[model samples]
Target chain A: MLDNPYHNKTLQWLAYAAVFLLIGIVPLLTDDDFLLNQLATYGVYGLLAVSISLCWGSGGILNLGQGIAFGLGAYGMAMTMQMQSQAPGTIPPFMANNALETLPIFWEPFWNTGLGIALALLVPTLFYLIFGGLMFVARVSGPFFAIMTLAILSALATVFVALQPYTNGVNGISPPTGLVIAGTKIDPYSSTAYWLVFALLLICTFTAKLLTQSRFGLVVRALKDDPERVRFLGYNVAVYETLVYALSGLMAAAAGASFAVLTQYVSPAQFEVGFSISAVIWAAIGGRGSLLWAMLGAFTVQGAQSYAGDAFLNTWILILGFSFILVVRFLPGGFAGLAELLLGRLASLRGGRREEFGQAPAKGAAK
Target chain B: MANALILGISIASIFLVAAIGLTIIYGTAGVINMAHGEFIMLGAYATYAMQTYFGLPYFLCIPCAFVIVGAIGFVIEKLLIQYLYHRPLDTLLATWGVSLVLIQGTRLTFGSDPKYIQMPGFLSSNIELGGVSLAAFRIFVILAALALIALVWFVFYKTDFGIKVRAVTQNREMAAAFGINSKQVYSFTFAFGAGLAGVAGALFGVLNIVLPTMGTGYVVQAFLIVVTGGGALMGSAIASIATGEMQSIFAMLLNDSFARFLIFILIVVFLRFRPQGLISAGGSRR
Candidate 1:
């Protein structure tokens, strides 16, 4: 019997490698720009899922406002890219739309692409780290953390929209042209954007998997299960928590930047409550416990959305809403857990094991 | 400045009414009902239905919304929330699912267009006192909030049913052993909370636009108040007033949205320093 197939790292890596190989070769086989764009967006979404898995799944810090970081990243990338196309003296498009004559002081820094990218990732990471640090150091655990993040989510949703001149309000902001790197211009629909996002997605998942497998990851898991006990064991749980939260924010911001490049648009829409909640849903569905599965979970949901198209968006939400409930309530371990269970079943069947009644080992099914 | 204080109190009352239901459910049952906002939305929709379809007046629609949304809450408790007790994280996610379903369902039923509730002509007018002038509807809302809080306080302290609820709140296992049906208490408490949110929605519908998504905005405020208050009636009462005054004062000092951002930042700092809140819901196992 496969007593615990989930912890079998070899099987996980094999699956991951196969998926990565498939993503790599698909572009070579396909000529459709739309397909390439969609896949690129999915790759960015994979980063979002990986972030959630790291924080909520692995670190036990159910950050409901991860999308805030994602939006910040998108703004960072889009603003920097937008500057590449505009005149040096001119204001940002959104600021100009509001009839502001002078470019905002903040926008000036983003004109330098390297500084913008670094700031985009670092700022959100710092924000999330500080926020998580405050909450955890004060011993705010579980639902309180969730509630506070949720409050941040709703607040950011409004705050982003309220900052219309900067965010361009509901209409959203897109760069007038593709980002020019050296002599190469990267169009969102091109194979280059697809490969870039796909590479980042891989790097993010690998880094997360490494972290989760290391001693830091061990403490993170312990922190999730019983934080007080972890603290009692003389571990600085708050530092561990803050680090993971910052890491999650960094990953989310990277994905958001990828989104700005891959989709060529950024807006308050990314800061909406729906976007934040969807991150949780993806992690939940994909198997928050497994970093790879969580990324796939994002891919699965985003793929479904593309298939369904924008017309039935509400219908998609309705379906995901029900799935979210059922998964959380009945299938807490989600798809990865289910896969492990099925594998265990198959192993038992193949092994012809005759375990005594009441002797079946608990598989840690729903932690 | 006095006018702003009154307005702050008015906003405070609105927050209290909005949060009372959430406090009751979380305090007693320990379920952080994320769907609490959806119930608020349902309440508004119920009031709209009664007024538009049944041709009922706004005054009568309040009770109708209470009953209607409360019944829905009861059904939801029986079907889903019952399975989720003691599992706080699961309950949070499940209730969030419920909120999503409720929001999309409402949007599907009501369409995306904004709906309006017709209040009486008197409520449409403004009341003048000294140098202050405020909407009569605001005064009505304040009175409604006070009346609701008083009634909830009375229910929790004055009745036999209230004792059962308090017992359950203190210790569900002990309450069960003492022959108090804790499940029944939970069901009733959840229903009452939902009904309170219904009342909040009915009032807020007039105060803001009646959209399918209106509850999203209020839910954040409601949550902040509930947490700051430490999930007790008096805690919520004091917390709401404090939050409202801070918000009003910040708004007066800065721009409106800037004030909101500052309030959020302040709330986080406040919670970081005092996660147990201004007043803890004491003598109970969290």
Candidate 2:
């Protein structure tokens, strides 16, 4: 009825499945523990990129302060893990170093692992619901929304720095390189940690895929095309937009939580505008139109940086900037578009109807 | 107390100068111009290069920086911004890309080192009046801001070109039907805005260190000014003055960074209540 709402849904899902499978088997295929850990780290980043695509791509919301969501999640995990390492009522190490007499009141509840994980997902969602909801309800969209998010990113990072007593200042909160349970320190670098990250990535990818394919997703996609038409059709556009913003926040928080567990650290840098812009760039390069490609784009960019950044630290940013321009100007479909073209050509040569695989009319959301 | 007040005005003037160009470009072209700060950065670098290599005086570097950066802005408008005017978000991202390229290009050329422009001796001296001592350069900046504001007013309100820009901005199709070339108006307005940014940069280089990344530091404030001002000359001026004074007073009472944080929070709250900013330009709210 919606004209096959999803373009090549079967093929897209298959592509996602194949990529997930490939990610899943990497650890098993390689004896290199270091490489495994690196990919695991990238797996967390990939989740952030997917969250960007989920909002900017599917939901037609460009949230440039996505790092703030990640930062909230990471800080949640870091605080919990930090408290776990310390005896009850003792000041955290960083605070103690700063000569704070006691642990801050906010840090008191984070001692519980369950509360920490809950807060990791909840804090960012709450922020997005309120912040994004206010903007959407007030009918502020387009570049204005983008700038507001950018401002939030800048402000949040500075706030993190200014609130040094709670955030450990610019030095950030780094937990010990282990998980604390009851009274024992457990190695976080173990295979269990790696698998945990991989599992979360898998869950998030599938969850997003499922969510974007639902009836609500259809309405949301329609909202992107024409808000007036959707509103006239009796949909509360603000509530739906806010819900998608919160969902994106949840995804980002998940990535942040995993990032803290993997790195044993949470820094104010996570809230930086550069970090947020990188997520946007990843989404654009991977084609904001597809969540799977967005995830791949993050991995590709991060992987390339890991390998080439050491030698061309300065040139890397220039290259990234240029590629972003080229993509936006000439290849709006991004890497996903390139893939679709190749596959479509192959299908046509095999005598398939062109209309069946034709590119859907570009949505009005971004294009 | 008086010193702090003067200091506030000086800070406001810097934001006002940088924001004016943004206000004009955005108000006329409906383009957000994300590279506004980078244009400022280019101006500073351009001044630094001229001063060091060509033995150009600081006074002369201001106009030279304008022409140099204005040309670049003109080229950007013609090559990139023209295509994305219909798509606001794409223009935002494309301009962001342009900013990144400009910043990194400057870094590669200038090697990330901070450069300073030499000040005229009289301008660098401290001026004392009524028990308040202020840097002469600060006074000059304030004067320059007032002068530029007056100049912009004269150009926008009185000139034939200003009428063309206004005509195009008000109703593009009608303006075109009336034989005005919207394309040239957009290009000139963009370049003029960019030239203003370059002048702000030349002034800023004297106040602080000039680095490729320095644009970032000023761009946020400039953007806030433009947004709060609602993308109008008067609105931007009032917004910059308000934010500048608020920041200075807060800094006097609290830490500088804390003051900034508070101002940003206030802006967020203000935007939530008034997303169209302090002044709405009527009709479409794009």
Candidate 3:
């Protein structure tokens, strides 16, 4: 009988689970508020990263306009918070600056927190539903899909900049006072905010894990591998693509909400093409197919940029650009694949025998 | 009204020149060349460097700009893009990186502030046609753009090299099997495209502020035009002028932001109905 002590897939999953748990608690162990705050920001970015991985990796749909979804979420949250901070029945600072005498029609519904969150998630989802439905139904894929999403992003940014009365143009909207939770004020910069973000990150990751392991995930993977084959099997490929795209947009909105609560400000600059491209870089740098790796990639890349300070700050774009090149050139499987490759090599060195773990090691390694 | 027409034509002329180059390369190579805008930036900077730093005459500096920037494009194709043709996404990523590097490099070499390109004395005066007055330079820019287009048309439709280029664009492997030098044609075509963008930049440098970040905005507009025009050289030329006229007329009637929103909505709707574009050349996968 073959020695199979190390062949349990559950143990492999547990190992990944443990790493994520440790990452979750790192803020609690550290006493530094700044570090904790940074971790919280990374948690928000992690949420977005997971969103990208879920749709792009599993569905083989690379969305280059994720920033728009993030912007929708941020704006939704910011509008609500702004409404709350105002004296009851008074115009908010943004509206006042724009010389609006009365509350805008759209701002009326966002007065309630529940409605705000729902709108934040629903707006991006609906936007994707219409866009994804049209594009997916037409069988748009590859570079065409990338370009179309980019066009949508460009249009969205332009609209935000042009609609100064509502969006404050380039000035963007600011967060209200710290988040109010059941009569207790929670300072966004406080440890409590960090814990809330941490909880959301965990929930997002678990949800993504559950999703990727489901039958739907299998269908998505199947479509990625061979669209025609999946179609022949009587699967509605367009529906699958649209659902994944909408789900990804929803997750992106959630991340944006967390970001607004954390940063307390939202701007048109935040939704630039560069921001969308950065999400792609994050997913590309992390192994695309793996959720934990995507989060790790987001955290590590963003953390490095944050710690690098002003001198290295301007060079961040160049660094990201080159990092993307290097990753694409050598580490086609991204960091996760690199790690798995190293582990495989180490395993081979330990015993002069080949071992198989979780699907084929080579399959899905190229992203 | 005449001045508005002149201004619209001048704006359309600059976009037409750049868009034509972009369409040619995109159609032939199936490469989007995200760095196409960077070439325009390079041209603008090259002209600035020659005129300001080297003390060259305005007329002499413009052609120099084209040559220098075209050379850069040639080098970029041979060193970077040639290897990336197999992987379209990789090309997009790598060129995007190149664009960032070029923009920052320009910002570092020349300060982030906008630079001015002085117009020659002859091209500076206003000429009156009927009751309306138009800048002499604006008329000259339109004429120059038309001349360039005519020249390109002649080269493509009236020469063996053009035939080979079209053949290669239609089928690269088949062209190679037929003993056509497809690689050389690609390099030359890319260089030609960059040269056109350079010319557009040189002309635009006189009409507008030349800044490192200016390329991004224009490039996005050019991209929209290319997609709207059906990704063909003729399509881009006609669509660019039409789009410019629409934008200009809309701007006259409405706020700039509202006009922009209207155009965006129209493009989105247009794309929904005819994803292949108004004048698709039949080879585009989209």
Ranking by DockQ: 1, 2, 3
lDDT of 3 by residue, A1-367 (tens): 2222233358657966897789767766877877777788888888888898898778888888899899999999888788778777888877777899898889988778788878988999999999899888877776667777887888788889988889898999886586565677767767888988988888888887877778998899898778889999999999999998998898899999889888888988767988888888888898777788888889888888777735676667667767777786667668877877766555544443444442333432442
Inter-residue clash pairs, candidate 2: A164-A169
Model 2 chain A weakest 10-residue run by lDDT: A358-367
Query: For model 3 chain B, where is the 10-residue window of minimal lDDT?
Result: B1-10
All models, RMSD in angstroms: 2.3, 3.2, 3.5
| Interface RMSD of candidate number 3 | 2.1
In model 2, which runs have C-alpha deviations exceeding 4 angstroms?
A1-6, A181-188, A345-367, B1-3
- lDDT, candidate 3, residue B41? 85
- Candidate 1 stretches greater than 4 Å from native: A97-99, A309-314, A354-367
Q: What is the lDDT of every predicted structure here? A: 0.86, 0.85, 0.80
TM-score of each: 0.96, 0.95, 0.92
Per-residue lDDT tens digits for candidate 2, residues A295-348, read 999999999998998789999999999999889888877897777666655644
The DockQ-derived docking category for candidate 3 is: acceptable
Write down the C-alpha DockQ for each prediction.
0.73, 0.71, 0.48
